[model samples]
Target: MLSGVGACPAVSAAEADTTDNAALNDANTTIIVTGLKPDEGQNKISQSGALGAKTLFDTPYSISVIDAEDITRRQANSIGQIFANDPSVFSSAPSGSTNWWGTQIRGLGVRNYYIDDVPLLLYWGGDFPLEPIESVTALKGLTGFMYGFGAPGGVISYRTKRPTAEAMLTTEIGYRTSSVFYARADAGGPLSQDGRLGYRVNIGGEKGNAYNQAGINRLVGSLALEYAISPDLKWYATATYEDSNLQHEPFQFYWANYVGNSLPRPTYDYEKLNVANSYYKARTLAAATGLDWTFARGWSARLTYGYTNKYHRSNKMFVYMRNQAGDYDGYAYNFAELDQNHFGQAMIQGDVMTGPIRHQIVTGASFQQTDSAFGYNDRDYYWGNDFNGNIYQDQPFRVTRAIRFGTGGWPSKEQQRALFLSDTLHLGEHVQAMVGARHTRYRLADLDGNPLVDSGYRTSAVTPTLALIYKPAPYASLYGSYVEAMEPGSRVGGEYANVGEVLKATLSRQYEIGAKYEHRQFSLTLAGFRIERANTIDRLINGARHLTQDGLTLYKGVEAIGSYRFSDRLKLGAGVLHLGPSIRNVSAGNEDLRGNIPAGAAKWQLTGSAEYYVAAIPGLSLHGNLRHSGKAPTSDSNTLYVPAYTTANLGFQFNTLIGGRKVTFTGNVNNLLNAKYWTQTNIGEGINAAMSVRLSL
Candidate 1:
């Protein structure tokens, strides 16, 4: 990892210069592994959430890592796109609205995001940015013990690229369909002798009409710097900013509220669904400072403080042309919102041996708070008009503008405090066990930011994790683990007599068993898991009605992941996931839905990618990838479905020495077949493509 005399809390700084190291044992250090060559084999993930740097084979949980080098070559435009191809992840393309950042892992919504294991809350930001990020680590099960209170689905951890030991500069330019263009520059290096100080910075912007009238106007930048106070201590800070003005691009169905034949999915040239004048814009700024202290004799501490602020406004509009007539008014709404979040954490770790058993332990405390406000105004432009003309026929219609916003006030306020402890026990040469627990104090307030009742509804819960592992050979590892997570209860107000009362935190659990095999330059992982949670309902107890938690919503699945480096010129990767979800012991009202497939969920998903360098072209290669999702139920009623879909992509890359500098040019044609499909509640689709050039200095 990046350090002076020992492993610092951060990863390594020379990630860009390593290419011949293919061994996983030495790959745990921080460096965005860019899988650009066959020798570049190790794509190590961040072990912060796991308490130590363990390779994928050494870790007890199912996690996946794909570094930035892999991402840039894949033509992924957003962080979600980079991970969406994994079958285990359920991703929806952003409509550039409040729900843009939504992602579901293991059948549950995942909201907790981390940078180097530190928590961050994006209360109102429509999207989770991919800018300035160098690598990504995704935890695929309950993570309450690893982070704190959050969805049971898991956590997405991001690591920013550290300053390179050698100074260099890189610039990239790209263009896509719909008249969009972008440019970015990256530079980093040490600023003092013995590398006592270093810095890395990234700045970029994109503009013009992009993908279906979303009309993009975006800017992103970040600066990260670190200073070594001594051989045993260091200080680091980063400031990041992003701003965007995006036109609202609504999905055609808006199906959650209106399903079945009565509300037919609309179809128009996918490009026409976006109103030229409708828009959603937002800006976010965040800064964080941290300390990494390493004491003599296996003891160290890591701490960080962070602050984030965001503001956004939108004039959201959606057009449905399936049933249409003369120009009728379209639905529109205006909203303005703001959010602020403060986060902090302090952790200490130590290594010691008890007799023949060795122990590695970590203890930490965390705090997070968020305050937000929002308001909206609604209007119907078609309210005064009849059918003007059909939009699909290219009949131009006047775009309405609304500049007024309703008064806004704080609608929500939340705070959480937590203390956690974890230990890894080494019992023998081939056996190890991990145990951990977290105690959390959490509370929520009403819109007025006041307690629901007297002092407000406050509660606490304890979550734990246990795991055992065995490694019979250097190349193989097997493990089984059980973990539980919690989510704050649904809060209600004044209408009820017990208004101030708060339901206990809902508990969710997961049990998993997995095996990992690493031989030569290939890696494979196979696992099976089951997840469950209980639902609370009113029941008669002693002739009196009381809320009782019972019944189970269960999700079970099996998954396989593998990657191979066949030769100096060939590389390939693939994954498969399947889930079976059902509700058992449901209440009378939901009895009929028992065993029914859940809504917006695909039973099967698969992804694969390959790259082959051509011996004949000297510096040329072809790359292709495919993604598939099985048909999914559109709603809880199971009366309608979103058909199964597959998307194919093909691209090519050419690399060569240009004036003593290396330059790579690449391009891809996404949705190459233009197959119409629904990404969610939408029903219009089209062909998309992007091309870019990168020059290294």
Candidate 2:
């Protein structure tokens, strides 16, 4: 607990003085258990990803935590791979697109993501490898009441590793299919004898071919520092840098836009399907700092600030469209963009008493701003040809090069500010009620200095939440909640009457009820939720996305996640979920789409994992996984569908001593069946294998 007292929720004056110097400093250090002496609050819920550091059973929400061990065991390198274990989410993108975090949660795109509880706008455009990530928390459903302005999809908070109490160093070497090889290092230690100042650092690099003969090269590095100024106060800071390049962009397909008619999805050989000589280059730099303080009994305060900058450019020609005959109509475009983001938050939390009722309250203010500029340079030449070789074979760089085009504006700037308050009132020892609200002011500005309708407009909203939880027993809890959110809207296209106009923020609501049970090392959760968004629309103009609000969009789903420890040597983890989304209420002309399933939304998802440790062998372990995603709509008409597919993976780990130090070796094979299927439109990676070795001292 923040009070540093016992497991009890109550805070004593003397114990509160000890503060949360160690707890508040790390955004995710609150609930996750790790290291030699696992955190005492592992099974006990903490407000780590929510309003405060309160027990989970006392709170009303559906949440999931993915820890580092899970990451290592899965060998998941991308956001898509990481989410393969969770049925409640879909992580996939067009092969040639640079959108990495383009995953969907509960049938809605995760438009934004957070780092250390600080939002990083436009996350997809600037992808970061999971080299140093320590853990992640998925907070599902309406969150504006606890957070601020954001998509109703949910919030994903990424927490990186911090300095450990004990000095440590590790080195690893890994290999993947397509001749990819990489190396990494992690080291940390206390900077002072008093155990107050500490630091952790990670550095990694890779160079090799990626899927579909796409050459790849990249480097990633990060640094984390922490200083305990006093027993009651602490400060922390982090900085990161990443640079990546693709020698040849991967293959991309526009099913409906291409071919212009319904036809079975096409398949191509790995070497014969990708663009040749096309390239994508991206670079990013980020920094963050924060402070935590406990100044009075039963009270604590925190402040955090972070900033990020990204630059990306790409030129490719292999991305194409197919006519009725399946003949290719090649496309060539030069894309470039610059994005900058800033975030800040301040919070105060404490315990208060109202007669016989005990209330835990948290109040906070947060601000976020993003400035971006982007444009595409088009080519004057075109190619109409198709041969197995045409996919990856290039005529000449000069012939396919994109020429500078007329000026095209961008979404220059967006800002959001909000204040939120929440309270957990103990109705009795076994019953509690959680309530919260948020007021947000959001605005977007046009940098081209154009004065069009809805240009430089501002909008405001107030969202609220209420939930009740009943802890019938220490090992089980039941809860239900109702929450709402405000999602910033988009600017209308020039095709519309009010071109260059900004739409009012979309209002979304959610209802959820769930149960959680935890015993020893086993845990299980079952949840059902429904989400509705007002004013939703999706349309296409000249093969480009033109989004506008019409009426409403409703998405609902149910999911179950659980882990079972069968014995000291065996364990299992699994998840299953089903989602149904439809475009409701629309104009007369667009009524055909009403009651239609949203394109790209999957109907069912299931995942299972198993592992075993060999006691006699002392350091050997075995692991395997199975994942299935049912058929998904590929077009607004719902007639074009991507067939359902299943994939399996197997791996094993061996830990032993190297010169009296610890060394771990791992090997995994993915796509055991080499299944041919599409994840996004026509994007898919066939069979692949990887292995890694790590030595610690």
By lDDT, who's the top model here?
2
Instruction: Tell me how candidate 1 scores on lDDT.
Output: 0.65
lDDT of each: 0.65, 0.67
Per-residue accuracy of model 1 over 1-697 as CA lDDT, tens digit each: 1100011111122123222121222322223222322212222434655355555555677876656765676667654456645678766553333444456676655677776555656533425456677777678878878776776777777777667666767788998777889998888888998898998888888887655656778999998898999989999988778898876464324343332333333343645455556677878777788998998689888888888777776565543333323122345445566767788888888889999998878888888887666552242111122123344444344455446543353356778899989888988889989998999898775546445543366778898989998989766788999988887774332222343345657888999999876656566778899998765444445664344445676889988867676765566778788889765777776676677765666788888867676766655667777888787775545766667788777888666556656566878777677766665544433567789998777
lDDT of 2 at 643: 76
Q: Write down the RMSD of all candidates, one decimal each.
A: 6.9, 6.9
Question: Cα lDDT for residue 88, model 2?
Answer: 81
Which candidate leads in TM-score? Answer: 2
Candidate 2 per-residue C-alpha lDDT over 1-697 given as tens digits, one digit per residue, 9 for 90 to 100: 1111111111111111111112122211112222112232225434443377655555577765565555665676755566666778666653224664457777677765677776665553524556767766667777877777778878776777788777878778998876889998888889999989999898998888755566878899999999999999999998878898877655445554554444434453655555566666778777789999998999999888999877766554443445434445555445566778898888899989999899988998888888876552233212223323243344333334344422344546788888888898988788889888888898886655353634556888889889898888776788899998888876553323445556777788999998877665566778898899875555666666566678677788888877766665676788888887887887886888889877777879998877776656656677788889887776666756677888888888766555555666888877777777766534566678889997776
Worst 10 residues of 1 by lDDT: 1-10
Q: Given candidate 2, what's the lDDT at residue 687?
A: 75
TM-score of each: 0.85, 0.87
Task: Quote the RMSD, in angstroms, for model 1.
Answer: 6.9
